[model samples]
Target: MAFEMFPTVNKCESIGREKHTVVADMDGTLLIGRSSFPYFALIAFEAGGVLRLFFYVLASPMAALLYYFISESAGIQVLIFAAMAGMKLSSIESVARAVLPKFYAGDLHPETWRVFSSCGRRCVLTANPRVMVEPFLKEFLGADMILGTEIGSYKGRATGLVCKDGVLVGKKKADALKKAFGEEPPEIGLGDRQTDAPFMALCKEGYIVAQNPEVKAVTSEKLPKPIIFHDGRLVQKPTPLMALLIILWIPIGFPLACLRIAAGSLLPMSMVYHAFWALGVRVKVKGTPPPPVRSNSSGVLFICSHRTLLDPIFLSTALRRPIPAVTYSVSRLSEIISPIKTVRLSRDRATDASMIKKLLQQGDLAICPEGTTCREPFLLRFSALFAELTDELVPVAMVNRMSMFHGTTARGWKGMDPFYFFMNPSPAYEVTFLNKLPKELTCGSGNRSSHDVANYIQRVIAATLSYECTSFTRKDKYRALAGNDGTVVEKKHAHLKANKLMGC
Candidate 1:
C-alpha cells in the first residue's frame, strides 16, 4: 500500500517547525489506539446507559467482521448505529466535552504528539463523528480545524447515519482536505493506515505511524491543559473483552453491592468496618484518630479532601464512630441510605457557618471543604468556612480505588452514586488522619484569616495524600461536566423563605 512506502512519523523531524501546518489522522496517528471501539463503547454507555452498551457489545462481532472483511466505513457505521442511534445530541456533546478528553489525553501518541504539537497550525482528519472528536481536539490538542464524518440527527437525536459525504475514508478524506485547504496543502500529514494514504498524499510531507504496542503513551502532564475534572462510571477504557466482562459482572455485582451497602448501614458504627471487610469493601485507616470529646465541649472539626460521596462514611468507619458530615449537594436517596448524619449546606455563608458550628457543638463533625468529589490526585479550593468554625481541625486525606466502575457521576442521577460505588468488586478506601492544626494557626485563634487557614489545611491534606492542589471549585467542575454551576435548586418552601429573608 502507499502508506507502507511513506517514512514513519518517528523519522520526521519534530523540532523547529513553528511555521508548519500538520494534518493528522485521529485514532492511531494522534492517539496510541488503532481501533475506535473503546471510544464508541464509552459514548454508548455515557449517553444511552448500559442497555445501549450491551447492544453495542452484541453487535461488536459483526462490526469486527465487517471492519476486517467488508470495509472500514461499514464497521464504523455499525458502531455509530449501535452506540448513538436514538441518543440525544446534547448528551453526546456533554460526554465529548467532559468524559472523552480525560481518556483521549491518556492515549496520546508520544511520537505523533512531538510532530503535531510542534506545528503552528494543527488539523485532525478522522472517520469518527465530528461531534465526538471536535471538542477534545480543539480544547485539549489545540487543533486549528477538524474534518470528520458528520452524524445525521433529527430533532436533536442522532439518526446513527453518516451524512452524504459518508465516512471520511479513501478518496472522501482527500476530497475533504482539498475543500478545507484549497490550493495550499498542509506542510505535514500523519497517518496510520492505508485508508489515510489518500489525504496524506495531498500534504507536502507524509509520515506513516506504524503499529507498535511497546511505545509508551504521552503522560497526562505533557498535555496542553491538565484534566482536573471528568465524570463517567467506567474507570478503564472498555475494549470488547472488558466490555463483555462488565456486562457479565453487573448482574452479580448489583446484588453484591446492595448487600455491602446494607451491611454498612445496618451494622453498628464500631462493627461497620469489619462488616465492610466481610462484604469485600476494604477500609484502610492510617494515623491516630482523636479521642471522643465530652458532651459539653465543642466538637473536633475533621477537614477532609473529597474523593467520592462515601468519603465521610469511610471517615466515620475509620474513626469507629459516626461523624455528621456537611454536604453541598446530595440526593435524598443518598441521605436516606447514609449511616452517618448528613447535613445539607445552604451555600449561604452565615447560615452554613451557624449550622456547622451547631453540628460541631453537638459532637465531632466531618466536612469536605473542597465541596465536590475530584477523581484525580488533586484537591479543589477549600471553602474556608470550616477553618473559621473551629481551631480543633484535623485534616483527613481520603482516597478510593475501583477497578471496574467509578462510583460517581455529574450528569447521571446522584442517588445511584453509592450503589455504583459499591458495585465495584473489592472497592478500597484509604483514610489518613494528619496532625491537628495548632491553635495559633487557626482563624478562631485570631492568628490567620479564614482563607489562609483553609489554604493551610488544604496544603496539609494534599501533602499527606501526595496530591496537587488547584483553585478549581465546584462550579468549575460542573461547568466542565454538566454545563452548569453545581447548584441544586431548593424546594419551593425553602426558596420562598430565602426570598422573604432577602426581601425579594
Candidate 2:
C-alpha cells in the first residue's frame, strides 16, 4: 500500500484511548527530528569525549549516503559504530539516564504525543541503539516496552556492532511486534516514514505522522515526569555541523578560556569587570547596590540563587569589591584562581555560622544558601543558616547563559568548570539584587524563625528571577544526577582543609 493511504495521527481520537495499547516509531513519529545523528553525537560527546564526537561527525556523510541511497539500517549502523565503538557500556548507560532525558524532553512531537501518551500502554520502535534510548523512554515517557536495535558489548564495553538480529527496520519491526504480542497486535500504531509502514500494517489501526516543521514541540510540563536534573558539558544538541564547529573551536576557545580565567584571577576587583567584557564574558548588574560598609560595621550578607560556581565572583564584580564568599565543594583550582577570598564551609552549623560571622565583621559576605548550583529555573531549598547569622540579608538572583558548553558537570572533573564556562563564545551573567531584609523581618529584630527568613529570601530571589521554588535540596540534585548525596570527604593529603563539603 502507498504511504499516503494511511490516516494522519491527528485524525486519530486521543481523548478516550487510555485503555488502548500503542506502538510508535521514535525518531520522527514521537520526536520532532527525523535524523538520529544529533542524539548519536550527544552520546559520543558525553560518553566518549571530543575525539569520539569528531570521529562521529567525520562519519556522518557516509551515514547520510547510506540512509538516503542504501538503507535506514545501514546508516544507523555507521552512527552506532562511530559513536559507541569501544565506549564503556556503563558510560553509555550513564549518559542515557542522566543526559539524554533533558534533550529528549525538549523534542517531543505534539501531535504524536497526543495519541501515544493517551494510550495506557506505549511501545517505542527505533533503529537507534536500545542501550542509548531505553532509559529515557521507560522512565520519562512512560513507555511499557522498547523494541530497538541492541548494541553488542563485551566485558562491559561496547563492541560498536549491533546484535545478531541487527537494526530493527522494515520487516524486522513487524517481526519484533509479532514476537512480543503473538496473535494479538497492538490496538494502534503510529509511524512517520515509509519504512515504518510494515509494522504499522500489523496494528489494528495505524496512523502516519506527516512531516510538519511548523509544529511546536510539546512542553516539558506535559511530560510524565519533568527533567529536573541532568548532567553533561554540551548546552545545545550537537548536529554534525555543530559538532564539527565545536571540535574546531576548542583549539581557539581553550586559550581564550585560559586568558579569561587568568584575567579574572590576577586583575584588581574594579578592573576585572572591564577585563571580563573585553574577553567576551558579559556581566549585567541590576538594582541599587548598597555602598561598601566600613571595616568596623558588620558586613551585609548577600543571599544568591546559585546558577554556577562564578556566582560570588560575578556578584563581587557587580559591586566592584571583593566579598568573601563561603562555598561548598569548590575545587582547589577554583579557590586558588578566585580573585575574592573563598572560605570552605564545614557542614557543621555552628562552625560555619562563626566563620561567616567573622567574614561579615571583615566586610560584605556572599553565600548561596541553596548549597548547590541548579541549571534549571527552579530554586532548591535554602539552607537557613545564613538567615540566622544576621538580619542584613540582601537577596540576589543570579542568571547565566552559555551557548556551546555548560560551565558545570556532575559526572566529570570540577576543575574544568570555569574553563568550560568561559569557552562559550559570549557567556553572559545577570546579577539582580533585591531589597535587604528589613529589621522587623529579621531573626535578630523580628519574631520570624530562621526557616521563615530563609523561605522569604528564597521567594524574593525566585520572584526576581522568574523561577519556581522547590523543596528539593542540594542532596536531591546530586542524588538524581550523580547517584550520590553531593557530599565530598576530604583526604588526609588533600589540598583543601574542609573535612566534608557539598558537591557541586
Candidate 3:
C-alpha cells in the first residue's frame, strides 16, 4: 500500500539544485514561525474587534471536537479555517495584502523561499484552503499551482464547509499532486510536518525545515535559519476577558505594587528575594561571582542583557544585594515604582559615560546595553557606552521564562507595574554571571575602541546559549517590525489623522 512509503529527508551542504518542481508546505516549512491559519486568524481578531477575537480562539477547539468525532484530522483543519467565517473576501484580502508583506519581511525559513522562487512549476500544496493561501502565493511567489481544501461560501463569508474535495491532508495531498501534475511525482518537495511525508515521496528528494532538530533529523539535518533570532512576540491582541482582567487588575495591581516597593525599603534584601517567590518566581543561577565583594564593591560594572523592566529587580534579588541600574527609553515614572535606584540615560554620550564612571567608582552598577527587551532568542548589538566607561566588565545573561503569560514585553501601557507581571501563575528566570571579560576584552587603556570590547562581550553570551550573534542593533529591529527602511523617523506628521497608515 502507498501507506508503506514513508518520507525520508536527505541533507546537503547547499541548496544549489536547479530546474526542479518545487512543491512546498505553507505553515512550518516555508514560514519561520507558526502556521498560516493561526497567523491569519490573529490578524482577523485585530481588525474584527474584541468579541470576534474571543470567538476566533474559543470556537476552534469546540468546532474541532465536533469535526473530529464526525470525521478526523481533516475535520480539525476545516474547523481552523472556519474561524475565518463571516468576513467578506475583499476585507480579508485587504488585511492580508498589508500584513503579509510585513510578515514576510520579518520571518522566513532560510532556504525554502529562495529555492522555491528559482525552481520550475512552483506549487503550494496544503490542507489550508486554496482561497485563503492563494492571494499571498499568487502575488508574492507567482505560484503556478496550489492544491488545498475547497471552501464553500455564501454571499461574502466562508461557509465553514469543505466543499466537494474535503481537507487535502497526508496521502490525499500526494494524490492531489498526482491528479494536478498528471506525471511522475514532483522533482522536489519541501515540508515540515510528519504528515507531509507521503507527498514528499512524490519528489526525487526532500528537505525538512523545522526548529526541532530531531524532527528535521528524521528526514535531513536541521536547516540553517537565515536570522538567528527573528521578532518573536505575538501581537498583544487581548480578548475582551483579558482586557477586562487587565482593567480590573490595574486598579488592584498598580496599588499593591507601590506598597510592595514601599515595604521593600524596610525589608532585608533576603526577605525581598523570597517575597518575589511568593509571587511565583523561581530563579536558577550559574557561575560564581568574584568572591563576595562587600555590598560596597567599587568599579564593578555588570553588563546585562534586557528582556523585561523587571530585569534589574531579578538581578539584585539573585545576587542577594542591591545593584543600582541605569537605562534608556523607559517611561518617565517607571523608576518611582522600582525598589532599586534607576539612573535614566541622558542624550549626550560623553556626559552619560562620565556619570557611569562616577557611579562605578562608588559601588556596583548594572546596565542593559541593548536598550530594549528582545522577545526573540538572539541578542541585539550591545551599546559601546558601557565598554567606554570602565573595563571591569562582568557579563550577566538574563532570561524570563513564561509559557502562558510572559513576564517580559516590548509593548504594553506605560504604567503597568512589575507586580502585574508576577500575576502570571509561575515565571521562571535563568541567570548566568560569566567570569569578568579578560584583560584583552577590557581594552580600556585604548588599544581598542569600546565598540570592539562591546562586540566581544556579546559574543561570549551568545556562544554560551548557542544563539546566533548578530550586529543588528535595536534601531534595526524597530525598523524591521515597523516595516520602515532605515533613516525614516516615523514621527506623526501634523496632518496625520487615521492610525497605522501604509503599514509603516
**Candidate 1 backbone collisions, by pair:** none
Q: What lDDT does the true structure give each of the candidates?
A: 0.88, 0.86, 0.62
Task: Report the error of model 1 at residue 366, Å.
Answer: 0.9
lDDT score for candidate 2 against the true structure: 0.86
- Provide backbone clash counts, one per model: 0, 0, 1
Report how far off residue 246 is in candidate 2 (Å): 1.0
2-119: candidate 2 lDDT, tens digit per residue: 6778999989999888889999999998998998888989999999888888888889999899999998789889989999999999999889888998888888999999998899
Candidates' RMSD to native: 6.7, 6.4, 10.3
TM-score of each: 0.94, 0.94, 0.60
Q: Which stretches of candidate 1 lie over 4 Å from their true place?
A: 482-504
RMSD of 1: 6.7
Rate residue 131 of model 3 by lDDT: 62
Candidate with best lDDT: 1
User: What is the C-alpha lDDT profile of model 3 across 1-504, one tens digit per residue?
Assistant: 132243423342235556667898877776665444355454454335435545565655655565447554555554545456676655554444434433543444555665676676788998776765665566545678888877767897765566776778777888898898887677778887667878887777777765542231111112212222222223342333454444355456545555555545556666876775665557778887654455555567888887778788778878888889998766655676566888878968988988898888778888998776655555666778888777788998887776434444333344453544554445567788999977766766667778778777777777776654445566766654443433212223301311122111
Instruction: Kindly report the root-mean-square deviation of model 3 from the true structure over all alpha carbons.
Output: 10.3
